[model samples]
Each structure stands twice: as C-alpha cells, then as structure tokens.
Target: MGWTDGYIAVDWGTTNRRAYLIDGAGHCIDEFEDGMGILSVPDGGFPNAVSEIRQRLGDRPLLLAGMIGSNRGWHEAPYVPCPADIDDLVKGLVRAGDHEAIVPGVSFIGDGRADVMRGEEVQLLGAAAAGLLEPEALVCHPGTHNKWALLRQGRIHDFRTVMTGELFSLLKGHSILADLLQGEVEPNDTFKEAVRHSIAQQALPADLFAVRARVLLGQARKEDAASWTSGLLIGCDVHIGLARSSDPQVHVMGRPELTRLYATAIKEAGREAIELDGEQCFLAGIHEIARRIDG
Candidate 1:
C-alpha cells in the first residue's frame, strides 16, 4: 500500500494519545503524545485531534488502539465477544474519516456477566507478538483498572477486571492515606515496607484509616510512604486475583520497574513472574489488527 511514504501507529489511552510515524518496516520516524485522550477531548474532537497528528506527517494512513474506539471516542465500536476469533477483531474495528482506523476492544460475556476493555486488548496482542503471552497464558495488566485475561490460540477465552489502580488513586488523594503524609514529599521506604506487610498479612481491605495506623504505630514511615501504600493496594489486588484463579504463571504488564517489583512479590508468594513492555505491546496490537484486517 506504500512505497514512498510511512504508516502511522497510535496508542490512544484514556488520558494520553500517542502517535508514531513509522517506515514500512515499522521503525518510528517521528512520534507525538499529548493529553488528547478520549476523556480529554470533546465530542467530534477525534477527527480534529487525529487531523492534527496526520497533518504532521502529510495525511498518512493511521492505525490506532486504545480508547479511540471506546464509547467516549469518535465512534463507539462494540466489544467483540470473548473466545473471540481474529475475524471478530477485524469486524469490530472502527474507521475514522477515511484513512485512520481504530482497534476494537474485547468483551467477556458469559454467565450473565459482561466486562469490556478498550486499549488493553491491543496491548495483549502486542504481548503475544513480543513472545511474553501465549494462547493459554494468564496475563495481568496493572493500570487504572487492572485486567486479567485467559487467552487460548490467540483468542481471548475469558477475563476479569479490577479497579485496583483507580481505588489506590482515590484512597491516596481523598482518604486517610492522604492525611498521613499531608505535608510530606515522598516516602520511598514507607511504600516498600507497606508492600511487605501487605503481602505478609495476605490481604488488605479498603481501610484507609488502617493504612494510617500502620504508619503512625511505627510499622511504616513517612518518607516514600506512597510506595508502601501503593504496594499494599497492588498486593491486595494480586492476592485477590490469585485466589480467584488457578493459573500457575503470572505475567505483569505496565511500567518495567513496577512490574519488576510485582515480579519480586510474586516470587515471594511462590509463583513465577514475567514482564512485558506496556507501550511496545500496545504497538504490536495495532500491527496485529492491521495483519488481520489487511490480510
């Protein structure tokens, strides 16, 4: 489809939109990301936001993944059902203007329950390409709402979603955790130690006051306390997911260092840990959609 020009790939999440102008072989030539996500823009702003980016590269064809295809984006593409095949992905894709395409999210619908995801599905495809995920692998994606999916033969067999990160954000900024460090800068060790105690205790509920008690009682510290608080939150999420599933291998998705810490925690919990690059995996997902559609 191209001999003289490059293609565009985008990872459009809820809070940020990133676009890359890439050569035919997929090496990025130029890139841009701003706070123009679905939540950031007004209705009918997708075309303009995308036009701004395409104009940067002289109006090239663009493939997008993430919230650009959500109900809040340009067009609301319905989630393709789980145990979903590649054709489902191809069919669920939403097109913008003429040349820009948005990848569809995935839905797990069974047992009278329906859970959907926008950007993470693309990331999972990318994870598959990166060789970190397999058809039967159990994957954990940590984010505003963490997602765990069971894939089989390149299809999403089933999945679960947890609002772990969002809860952490709320508890930290709006609850007792916020008051514990009202005037402090950061609590590095405090955060780490909180992670340890949370893991040791096997669970942590949404008791913000208890979080303060742990610190006030000298069980934790103020410096870097955010880490400990976050660790406890993440640990609780990990523990809950583990209890609900029998999957043996755990793969952590998102920030490498954070995933590393999760991996370390998983190891301490007697499990194997694996890591995947969140951004690159999302890119691979865009390519995966391209492969299925262009084929």
Candidate 2:
C-alpha cells in the first residue's frame, strides 16, 4: 500500500510565521500566514500559533525551520555538527510540540568555531540542488542581515553577515537626511548620479558632506537624493561582497527586485549572476529538512 496524506511545512521567522500544506510529493496545496514571529510571541505563544496552524490543516505531519528552533524560540534543537551530511541532520530531528511533527535547526561545529542556521540553511541546500555548487562557489543571500557563504565539496565552508538593510534604515530615519527629506519631493538624477559617483571611486570616501552639500547648492536634485543614497549604499555593499574573489559562479538569493538590481550592478562590473527563487527556496528548505531528517 502507498501513503496518501498532506503534511505542513512552516517557516516561522522573527516577525512572521507562514505555513503551507504540502503533499507527500512536496507540492503545496494550501497556505496560511500570521504575524507570529518569535520576537512577537509573548511567552508560550509558540504552542498557540502551532495549534492555530494545526486547526487549519487538520491532522498532518509537520516540519519547521527558522528562529522557532532557536534558544529563544518555543524549543531549542541543538545544532547538528557540520559539515553535516544527510546522516547528521536526520539524527537531530525534534518535535514542535507534543507528538506534533517538527524538525529542528542543524548546527555545525568545526575548527574550534561554531555556526548555526535555522530555515535558510535548508533552503540553501535546495538551491544548491539546482547543481550550481561545484568545487568552489559563493552564495549571497540578501535581506535584513545579508549572508554571504562559501561552499566547497558540497559543504558550507564559512559565511559572513552584513547589516546593510538595518544600517540603511537607521540612517534614513534617524540621521540629518531624515529632516531634509521627510515629505515626498521627487528623486531625480541625484540617485543615479550617486551610483555613478560611488562606482567611480572604487572606494567610498568617509566624508559624506559632498552628498548633501551638492544638493543644497543646487548641484543635485533633492528628491533624487534618497535614490542616490540607496544606490551608494547598495553599490558599496556589492563592492565589498565581491572584494575577495572573481569567482564566476555567484549565486544570489533574495527578493527578486533587489536581486535583479544587484545583478544589474554586478553585470556592469563584468560579473554574471544567477538568481535563486526566494519563495521556492523557502519551501525547498522545508522539504530538504524533512528529507535530511528522514534519511
């Protein structure tokens, strides 16, 4: 006999929780989302959120990833040692609540150093299945905390985190520029001009006096200032990320629009970029987690 049933895959992050009803073949049937991130949960909120998801889907096997498996989450699943292959991940599975099905984050400890990932880790594995991984490759995942990782021989070697989004938000909301450009004016040539200016320098100068003064002196459009600000920041980020090597295989994973913009910039700098579907990658992570756990 064959099994015919639905399973739930949940990617619960810090500010949001999303659940999908998937079949045995990893096809999504129904989906639901709520603002139930670990950060928003108020003591024992995990159980409540899990119950809500269960009620919506009825009785089904459940798998999860993201901060929900962190120490600050409902339950902390210890890290699965890395460079963990399939066997390691399978051995680390843990339930979400009661007999409710759930898989935990895998941890890797090597070289006297330790690292951890929740959901995205599994997603990366799925993307790599696209056959982009080789003996040497770089994967960049952009978001609030942009993650750049190095993979070799089918194993994640190391990674770095950048606070680009958070830094940009803080500057725009709390800096002097906030007062100067509160209401919508219009972003004109100033933004593109900023991109050109930043890209030209090869390295951004510490002094940003010119960025504002140019606008104040009527040299640049006031409305375009924000866009220019955005370009400069993003450009610098690209420059820094590509600083180490000229590897031809650069896989970018993130929001489509932003990734497209980054890809454009990268191409202009004579580099080709392969984009990974963010949503699919998220779902793929759950599937990969389940596979690893089952294996």
Which of the numbered candidates is closest to the native, going by highest TM-score? 1
| lDDT by residue (tens digit), candidate 1, 114-217 | 79888888777667765668766778887888887777887778888888778767876787677654443222545455556776786577434576776778
Model 1 lDDT-worst window of ten: 181-190
lDDT of 2 by residue, 136-194 (tens): 67777777666666766666566555666666677678876765445342223444455
Candidate 1 structure, TM-score to reference: 0.87
lDDT of each: 0.72, 0.66
TM-score of each: 0.87, 0.82
Cα displacement (Å) at residue 39, model 1:
2.0
Off by over 4 Å in 2: 1-4, 80-87, 98-117, 130-135, 179-210
Q: Show model 1 residue runs off by greater than 4 Å.
A: 1-5, 181-203
* lDDT of candidate model 1 versus the reference: 0.72
